[model samples]
Target: MLLPQALKKGDTIGIITPSSPAPVLFKARYERGLSQLERMGFKIKEGKCSKQTQSYRSASIQERSEEINDFIHDQEVRGIISTIGGMNSNSLLPYLDYAHLKKHPKVIMGYSDVTALLLGIYAKTGLTTFYGPAVVPSFGEYPEMLPKGKEYFEDVIQLRKKAPYVLDVPQEWTEEMLDWNTQDRQKQMVKNTGWKSLREGSATGKLIGGNLNTMSGFMSSAFFPDLEGVILFLEDSFKDIATQERSLSMLKISGVFDKIAGLIIGKHEHFNHLNAPFSIEDLLFEIMGETNIPILTNVDIGHTFPSHVFPIGIKVKLDANQGTIEFLENSVSE
Candidate 1:
């Protein structure tokens, strides 16, 4: 895998709205996110799409692709982070300049609907992309970004922390939502239950996966990578059990379960069971059938506060029996 150079103090981090026009939609929060990055000692460059909103998305596919490619070609931009995730990032895939990105390797990171971009870039270029915070919902968090969220970002991108480390179970987390435009307080966090082991055992493999719903957009395309021996981690927000069953069944039919070395199910944010007779885990087991890959669920990642960043192509050791994940190697180069 092509590891991007680690972000350093004063390095410019370019921000783009490949999906949502969060800057226009939530001006105050968006600017706060930029200010937070500035306070962290990095320069910021706003992509053209940041200011352009078309109802649900930032701009046309052509425009969004151009915005991201602009950062890719800019020699001074050390990293690229999404403003927010929306529903249409996959539309920009064919238009993305993968060759240019390959030649100019750098950090490209985000989650939610932007999973299309993160995993797409990794699949095309063998460049490790981050599945972590987007500016508005994460860094722009009111009062200040959550310390744990900021620390996780610093751990991976800035090397503020290092690898050969086991991820800490955050003592608290939140999925509480407020109107982004009128919000003024930090999210209310509750005691975290931490990770749970669904099946007991251990396995190690390159880490891959993001929002399960987002994968449907680009799955099996040239943008989706081979999942053989992958430690697949996925999560979602507001999805009901029926939808989850269909998605999981999609993966099952595609033989993803047979290929993966293990599975990590992240804590679902505001999940609805829809009055189903079975729990989400029961649904998962129904779809998984008899596959015996070590299964770990309720991990503190994706759509939840105090989330951890996962690099797309990094070797990871997942001991599901112990409910732990350890990065075996640093995901970025200096």
Candidate 2:
């Protein structure tokens, strides 16, 4: 696997709007995210799609791909991050300069709908991509980026913390929804209940996965990574039990459950049980049947506050019984 170079203090981080027109729609919060990066001692270069908008997305499909390709061709840009995630990132896959990215590997990070790109890039070029925070939703939190979230980002991207270490379960977290435009206070955080071990076992394998709903968009395409011995991690936001069943069933029918060595489920933000008699866990087990594997859930990842940065293609050990994840290799080269 190819590991991008660790970011340095003065590195230039290019920002792209792969899907959402977040920079245009949420100008103040967008600027705040950029400011956070600048304050962290990095230079920010806004991509072409940064200011463009086409109602739901930042730009047309071709324009969005062009924005990413431009960044890929720029030697000055050490990393690329999305302003936010939306619905059509998959449209840019066929047009991306994956070969160029393979040769000039750099850190590409984002979560939610950006999962399409993260998994696609990794699958096509064998270069690690991050399933982590995005600009408007994460780094641009009111007042400032959540301290723990910032720490986790730095730990992986900047190599401030090395591998062979277990990720910390945050002491507190929040899925509180506030009006991003009119919000004037920090989110209300609750005490973390910590990760839950659904199945007892341990497995070490390559790390891979992102937003579950987004995976369905391109799962049948060649861009999707092979799950053969991966410790897959999945998360979603604002989804109900019914949707969760369908998403899980997609994996089951595809033989995904049989291929993975372990599973790490991120905390689902605003999950609606819909008055169901059974929880998602019960549904998962029902679909899984006798296919036993190590399973851990409710860990800090995805849309939740203070989420951990997961590097796709890195080797990781998941101890489900203990509810711990330990990275076996550095996510980036020094």
Expressed as tens digits, the lDDT of each residue in 188-234 for candidate 2 is 99999999999999999999999999999999799999999999999
RMSD of 1: 0.8
* Strongest candidate by lDDT: 2
Shift of residue 282 alpha carbon in model 1, Å = 0.8
Candidate RMSDs in Å, in order, are 0.8, 0.6
User: What lDDT is reached at residue 124 by model 1?
Assistant: 91
What lDDT score goes with residue 92 in model 1?
A: 90
